[model samples]
Target: QQQVKQSPQSLIVQKGGISIINCAYENTAFDYFPWYQQFPGKGPALLIAIRPDVSEKKEGRFTISFNKSAKQFSLHIMDSQPGDSATYFCAAITSGGSYIPTFGRGTSLIVHP
Candidate 1:
């Protein structure tokens, strides 16, 4: 039950619009959730994250809304720009010793100008 399922394998949005991606996990043991953004030919970098203790977290134009009871989370990008076009991944990891994250299949977002 360590799997994380992401939806809308691909998304397209106009500039100044909002882009949203959703993810769900089956493992309640996962206590740490992080999102990553990656551009072509570059490694993924940490974008934003949220723990079960918090219902939501926001950083700049990016926001993560989490539902501990539903075991689900989503990322919302406001005023999406072309520069925001990239592959996003949602991951979860267990607490305590192991820090290895279980990643979703990833969602590719493209913002049109």
Candidate 2:
């Protein structure tokens, strides 16, 4: 079973707005974070990630922010668009164990243009 919990099962954002998704992991052993975005009829792709050493990581308009002490992390989409609509999953990978990813329930994001 995955130890991560995500919130806001679904989200609706206006075009050019900001879309945010949050997740919390229970295992302190987890050190790697990966955020996946999946489109219909497609597999999830690595969207972005934040390392435990950094509080935040930003790439283009996408950003990943985390609180190592809180064991919480989040994904942020800036200037959201209709094309950005998809199901987002937050995952954590253990540093010493199997190195396998344990995913959260996922959040569905709908961006209206």
Candidate 3:
């Protein structure tokens, strides 16, 4: 079984600061990297993702930077706000494999106004 390790069990950031969460995976077969965000009483939602082909990807205030050689990826939230406060999880999935995602433990983000 592949293992995904995420850093920083929790995080606190200012309303306009940048929040970064990192994750590392053991499987080289993993092809997709997606970051999921979940708020209270809600299922995880895809925030952003990046493939090994791309080094970086950006969507709105969220960005995913991937390092294939390092087998790691990170999520960068720019201009983070209190509304963005949620538990973030990193996941990896392989289309040819089971297609089941291996997720990180999750990081709770608290943005202070």
Top-lDDT candidate index: 1
Which of 2 and 3 is the better model by TM-score? 3
- Please report how far candidate 3 places residue 48 from its true position, in Å: 1.1
Candidate 1, run of 10 with poorest lDDT: 1-10
lDDT of 2: 0.94
User: Alpha-carbon error at 72 in model 1, in Å?
Assistant: 0.3
Estimate, for each residue in 8-88, the C-alpha lDDT of model 2 and write its tens digit. 899999999999999999999998999999999999999987679999999998999999999999999999999999999
Q: Where does model 1 exceed 4 Å of error?
A: none
* Count: clashes, candidate 2: 0
Off by over 4 Å in 3: none
Query: Residue 79 of candidate 1: its Cα lDDT?
Result: 99
What lDDT would each prediction earn against the true structure?
Answer: 0.95, 0.94, 0.94
List, residue by residue over 1-113, the lDDT tens digit for candidate 1: 54999988999999999999999999889999999999999999999999999999999999999999999999999999999999999999997958888999999999999
lDDT of 3 by residue, 56-89 (tens): 9999999999999999999999999999999999
RMSD of each: 1.1, 1.0, 1.1
